[model samples]
Target: MTLEADLRGASAATVRGAIERGDPLPGTAGFAGLVDGALVRDVLGRELVYVDREAAGEGASAGARAEANGSASVWSFDPGGLADPELLPAGSVRPLRGDPAGEDRGEPGGRQVWTLPDPAPETDEGAAVAAVRAAVRESVDEVGSTGLAVAFSGGVDSTAV
Candidate 1:
């Protein structure tokens, strides 16, 4: 199983647990940190979606059933993650549940916003630094030997890696 996200809270751990439990999706906030997110099937034949609850038009869909963000006006249930406006024509409108104020009713849409716990304060700064150095060194060595390629865009994350 593979996950892609700039996760916060217990999201990474939660994903690990979900993989161990053989669950597709572990939690919703596990998806909150994503930007320009979309659902698609990977080469391994696994279906994945990235949904940010606060976003207007993002949700996870497996075939006919889709959970869309309440604010979204136009949505696509594309399995290939390519929702290009010019290439792909408009998809059918699948309305989500809402109140008079247009707030998300949740569920049925499979929208569950998880409140993550506050991160524990860091101690043993030197040890933490050393651990990070060791991990990064290991990663660099492995990537060097394997000839690695990253999805780089000169961002902080890409550069740091």
Candidate 2:
């Protein structure tokens, strides 16, 4: 149930064995853009990530890579960021880019580098709800009494927090 504001910190910390994501939330979920120009959507697809329809695609020049690189110009978790955005596939990882420092190709859905692992396997409906509730509650418990005000956007993720 981490807020989008927290993603900056969480994403910054998720490199290999040194993740510092806030808890009682366990492991990870949601959308995160790595410093290495990779875009990741969580296995649950709980958070939506989108790429500009015109900006989506694979095989481009280095210049196009710089322009994409999972930066604000090419990707947004909120669909409103683009006039027409393509919902990034769930549990997927891809680079929003082109070739190195050269010709720019206008394409969509760039080459996928990795598909995030699904750590939470399929479970019974009730069990799934319980698990989700537990994770969210753990996160809420940590954040609720912090005495800092949080802005709620009324989205399912923010509302849960």
lDDT (tens digit, per residue) of candidate 2 on 124-148 = 9999899889998898678655678
Steric clashes per prediction: 1, 14
Please give the lDDT score for candidate 1.
Answer: 0.34
Q: After aligning candidate 2 to the native by TM-score, how far in Å is the CA of 155 from where it should be?
A: 28
- Give the backbone clash total of model 1: 1
Clashing pairs in 1: 56-72
Model 1, 13: alpha-carbon shift in Å? 21
lDDT of model 1 at position 95 = 23
In lDDT terms, how accurate is model 2?
0.48
